[model samples]
Target chain A: MAEIQLKDLAHSYAADPEHTTDYAIHQMNHVWEQGGAYALLGPSGCGKSTLLNIISGLVKPSHGSVLFDGVVMNDISPQDRNIAQVFQFPVIYDSMTVYDNLAFPLRNMKVIESEVDEKVRAVADILELNSILQQKANNLSADQKQKISMGRGLVRDDVSAILFDEPLTVIDPNLKWKLRRKLKQIHERYNLTMVYVTHDQLEASTFADKIALMYEGKIVQFGTPRELFENPNHTFVGYFIGSPGMNLLEIEVTAEGAKMGEITVCLNDQQRRLLKSAGNASLKLGIRPEFVQLSSQSNDESMPCTLVHTEDLGTYKIVTVMLGEHSIKVRLDEEQQVPEQNAYLNFPSQWLKFYADDYLIVTDETGDKS
Target chain B: MNKIQNNRAWFLVLPVFILVAFSAIIPLMTVVNYSVQDIFDQNNAYFVGVEWYRDVLQDPRLQDSLLRQFMYSGSVLAIEIPLGIAVALMMPTRGAMASLSLILLAIPLLIPWNVVGTIWQIFARADIGLLGYAINGMGIEYNYATNATDAWLTVVLMDVWHWTSLIALLCYSGLRAIPDAYYQAAKIDRASDWAIFKYIQLPKLKGVLIIGVLLRFMDSFMIYTEPFVLTGGGPGNSTTFLSQTLTKMAIGQFDIGPAAAFSMIYFLIVLLVSWLFFTTISQLDKNKT
Candidate 1:
């Protein structure tokens, strides 16, 4: 296994692309540590596949070198790179049996027949494909075909990594869970570096130890799921990771605190000082719905707002409240008391995130990553 | 909810039945009648049954032409299939060059079969034609009108020139239909060029190849117009295929009983071979997704 690194890498489909819009992947540097399970998560067309392909040597970047274990492999072909990739759809040799499909990569590498047989049988056993080892790949179900596709990589001894490009997309929902657990087992057993590319947050969070959240072709955050939920470095992360996402409100920075039309959101003196020194920049206050507090009556630490709507989500209740023009969503416990009218909302200072220009602004005593 | 079922779909197929009655059934019945009886006049006939069938089957001239027909079709397929695949693989896949190449390849297929024969007839003439003059210039004594081998070669070459494009076009579309992911996957698997073709490309093209093979086989088996135009059954029936021999028997010599029986046998052979080919290929590809 080798650590794959992207050093100032960028890609543009056009030959002589001048504008940033032409670039599918923006200039960036990232690293996938050896033997680590990582996810490159993004929305569609945000260049997740392009990044994955570059790492696997399916694509050569336009601007920068891809380094493997500190060696430049920019000129190496995919075959010589010794990386395997499972595509969005299962790509199996239709005429070959499951045994042959699992043994394909090693056979292509011209491994001896006895060793090839050993690896094939071992991989088939792990993938639970031993039962259908003699069956033609074309007759197997899609998930089985995908497992065979994965097994092609697992059979090889010299593979640097196995990249998964949304490999579970065509699987049934229940089968996806099974396959994911199988992948986790494979990763644990073999200690192979695996990078999974997907647009699904749940899949990324569950399957990856750390996720590189990409936005507009740039990796906006690289952290654990808990870290992303607790401390979002980019406003897009705050908006993208949670179920209902974070509720952001436009505010004006001042010496005392941020002004929201008629009321003020008090910040610590250090944050207030930072805002005062920054001087009249556009600002936003972001808080996750789960973190917001609801008070039935107007109090010293609460701001009175109109209760617009309430939704029961089986386990918890989310209540939308309006403070002037901004609609804010607050999550309350299922058994928690919620006042029909005159409900007040509190944005706990510890949970508040201040954004200057769609990015989190850090100051002294800002984030409690608990 | 109660469902209405009136077998209205059968009524929708009435037009096709009427069409088949006038187009296929009546003419075939007349031929069958002609084959089964000895007719002195329209009013007088005697049952002769399978006598014509036996006579047609035992005719040595027909037997010779049948062997020649198989040889001709076999040569056509053997030469054309591989050559077409090579040309298709070598052709540009996209952009202005690809379009231009496609248009150029379609040129031969667009020419009428008789026109193709006439073109080659003059083109391969010994004294005046470009091909024959060039060959004679190269010190080869080639004259199709007098030499049986030369005439056979000329007809086969002409057919190849006229029809290899059909196979090439079918394979080109098949190759283009393969997704880029397969190539990428093959590269990752470290498959050699030949391995990629043998495993991925050939297996994927089976559907298109089946269609091309069937089309070429049937068309070549029933081939008449091109050789007929060029050779006119030759100096001594040198390039006379089965259809030409049948034509000579039916129209030229007016052997009605024998010709009808021969026609029936010929039709059955085409139908049987085509069915065999279709079944074999589809069975091999039974579990295709």
Candidate 2:
């Protein structure tokens, strides 16, 4: 196993990238520690796959370098890098038996036949594919085929890392969960560095110890799932992580206080000073929907909001409330009652986050100003 | 729940039945009738009772031509399949060069069979032809008119030139149909070039190879026009195939009775071999799965 590092790595599919938008993967420095299970998470076309490909040595970056164990690996071939990649679609030798498919990588390295057989069997046993080892790979179910694809990677002991580019995409839903758990187990048993690229937050959170959230070809944030949920560094993260996501409202800073229409929000002295320094820059108040307290009676810190709709989602309810011109979603518990016409919505001070120019302003443990 | 039996479906199929009978069945029945009878004139004919079939089957001339047909078909398939696959593999996968290669390779296939034979006939002439003259200049006696080896080589070469492109095109299409993921996976697996070809490419090409093999086999087995135009079944009948022998018997000698019988046997042979080919390949496919 090796620590894979990207030293200001950037990639572009174009022959000449004239602008930042032209790059598929924007320049960034990141490291995946040895034996760490990391997920590269992003929306589609957000460069997660491109970053994964760069790490696997499939695509040469247009700028910077990829280093494995502190050694430059940009010029190395994928095979020489000793990295295994399971693609989005299951790729197997259609004519080969399941056993042979698992044994392929080992055989390619000229590993001894007996040892190859041993390794293949061990991988098959782990994948629960021993029963169909003699069966041709072409005839298996989609999930089983994907398992065989994963088995090919697992069978090779010399691989420094295994990269998965949404390898569970073609699998059935139930099987996807099972296979993900199996992969987690495999990662623990082998202590192999695995970098999973996916757009799914749930999958990333479950599979990875830390997730690198990419946006517009740049890694916007890299942290644990809890960190991402609790303290998103970018407005996109705030809007992307949760079910209904964090509710963001445009708040204009005035001499009196932060103002949202006629409702004046009470802010501390530091916040008022930061807002004053922020000048005319666009500022937003971000609070998770779960943290939005809804009550029938108005209070000192509460703003009156008209209830537009309430969706009972069995476990919890998503209540969309109109606060002046802004539509704010408040996630309420199953037992929480919705006000008939209007309600008082309160943004808890601790959970309240402030953003200037669409980026979360770094704050200390105690929520403060900029 | 009981299923409904639709007797009205036969009425719906009546038009197709008549069309097939007129197009295929009636003509085949006529051949069958001729094969079973010794026709002396327009009306006067005698019941042969498989007499013609016996004569044709035991005939040494037919046997020799049959063996020659098998050898020619087998040799052509053996040579063309590998050669076509190699040509396809060597071809550019994309861009202007791929299009140019495809157009260039398709030229020989576009030429008519008789025209190909005629072209080769003039092209391989000992005195004036470029090929024969070049061979003679290299101190090799290469007269296709009198030498059996030269005639056979010319015929096979001409066949290869005319048909290898068809196989190549099919194989090219097959190769193109394989996704890029397989290649990437193979690369990551550290598979050797030969191993990739053997394990990945060759197996993927099986579906198209089956079609190529069947087409080349059936076409080569019944080949008459090319050799007839070039060699005229001469050079001591060294290049005479079954179709040429059948054509000679039916049209040259007008031995309709034995020729018709031979035609039936030939049809059966082609059908049986095709069935065997399909079944064997399908069995191999099943065994793998």
Candidate 3:
């Protein structure tokens, strides 16, 4: 196994790209450690698949070098790179049995018959496809065919990495979880560097130790699930990662602090200085629904709001309230009492995040803004 | 609940039944009538039972032409299928080159069979034609008009040149229908070019290949215009195929009764072989799926 390092990597489908907006993957530098399970998470057309293809050598990036264990691999072919990629659709040899389908890569590498047989059987057993080993691949169900495709990748021992391009798209929902667990088990056993590309947040959170969230062709945040949930480095991440996402409201910097319409918001001196120095016309304050507090009694710190609606989801309730012209959501526990039509909401200072021009401001551990 | 049977539906199908009766059944009945009778004139005829069929079956000329027909059809299928697949595989997959290649390959298939025969007839002449004159200049002594083997070769080559493109076009469409993911997966698997062709391309092209085989078989078996024009069944009847022999029997010599008997037998042979072809290929498909 080898660590994959992408240095100043960028890709553009256009023959001659004059601007960064023309790129499908903007310039970025990142390294995936050996034996790490990582997920490249993004929306459709966010260049996650393009990044996966570049790593697997299926695509050649226009701008920089892809290195494996410090060795430049930009000119190497996929066969020489020794990477296995499973595509979104199940691609199998229709005429071959599942056994032979798994054995295909080994046979291509001229591995001995005995070793090929052992590897194929071992992979089939892991995929729970041993019972249908002799059955033709074309006759199997879609999920079973997908298993065979995955098994083909697993059977190769010389592979340095395995890349999955939404490999579970065609699988049944119930089977998707099982297949994902099996993949985790295989990853642990093989200790192979695996990169899974998907647009699904739940899939990424469950399958990857670290997720790289991409937006507009650039990686906005690369951190653990908890880190991303607690502190999103970009406004896009804050909006994309959670159910009912984070609520953001535009505010103006004032002599006292930051103000929304006529009400003043609580902010530390460093945050006030950052806001004053930012000089950006657009500044936003963001907070997750789970952190927003609602109360019936008005206080000096709480802003008055009009309750638009409340949805009692079995486990928790989501309260949508209007503060001035902005609609903010508050997620309350099932045990918490619901507020009436008119209520006062408080944005906890510790949970409040400030964004200047859509990018989160970097703050020190001592609460001093950078 | 009881379901009502619609008897009025029979009236709606009457037009189709009348069309089939006039077009198919009536002509078939006429052939059967002619096969079982000794007809001296349109109105003067005598029932001869199975005598004409027995005589026609025992004829040596019919046997020879049947064997020749089988050999020709078999050769056509053998030469065309592989050649067509190779041509299709080598064709460019996209852009202007692909379009240009498609138009170029389609040129021969658009020519009428009779015109193809006429073109080859003049093109294969030893004295005036480039192909024959070049071969004769090299001292190979090629003359399709006088030699039986040369005539057969020229006829087969002409058929291959005129018809191989049809099979290639069918296979090209089939190959194009395969998704790009298969190739990507194969490449990741490190499959060699031959293994990719054998496992991926060949299996996917099976459906179109079956169509090509059946069409070429049926057409070559019933081939008439090209050979009849080029060879004229000359050089001691060496190039006389089934259709030529049957035409000589019915029209050249006007032996309507025996010719009708032979026609029925030929029709049965073609029908039986086509049924066998369809059933066997479909059975293989079912077994896999």
Per-prediction DockQ scores?
0.58, 0.83, 0.76
Tens-digit lDDT string for candidate 1 (B1-289): 9988889879999999999989999999999988998887888888899999999899999998999999999999999999898888889999999999999999999999999989999999998899999999999999999999999999999999999999999999999998888899989999999988888888888888888888999999999999999888686987899999999899998888889999999999999999998997777666543
CA deviation > 4 Å runs, candidate 3 = A260-264, A295-297, A309-319, A332-340, A365-370, B5-15
**lDDT by residue (tens digit), candidate 3, A1-370:** 8999999999998999999889999999999999999999989999999999899888999999999999999999888897888899999999998888999999999999999999898888889998999888898888898888888888988888989999899889999998899889989999999999999999999999999999988999999988788798788988998877899888888776678886678788877766666677589888999999999987878888899998999899999998887898999999998876569999888788888889887645435332
- Which residue window of length 10 is worst by lDDT in model 1 chain B? B280-289
Clashing pairs in 3: none
Per-model lDDT = 0.89, 0.91, 0.90
Query: Can you give the TM-score per candidate against the true fold?
Result: 0.95, 0.96, 0.94
Candidate 1 lDDT over residue span A1-370, tens digit each? 7999999999998999999999999999988999999998889989999998888788889999899999998999998887889999999887788888888888888889999999999999999999898888987888998998899888888887999999999999989999999999999999989999998999999999999999988999999999888888788999998878999888887665788888788778776765555455677888999999888877777888898888999899988888877889988889997896678888888788877777777755544332
lDDT tens digits by residue: candidate 2, A207-319 = 99999999999989899999899888788999989989898878988776778887767787767665666567799988999999999988888888899999999999999
Give model 3's docking category: medium
lDDT of 2 by residue, B122-148 (tens): 999999999999999999989999999
Sliding window of 10 residues with minimal summed lDDT for model 3 chain A = A361-370
Best by TM-score: 2
Model 3: chain B TM-score vs. truth? 0.96
User: What is each model's TM-score for chain A?
Assistant: 0.95, 0.96, 0.95
Off by over 4 Å in 1: A277-281, A364-370, B1-14, B286-289
Better of 1 and 3 by DockQ: 3
Clashing pairs in 2: none
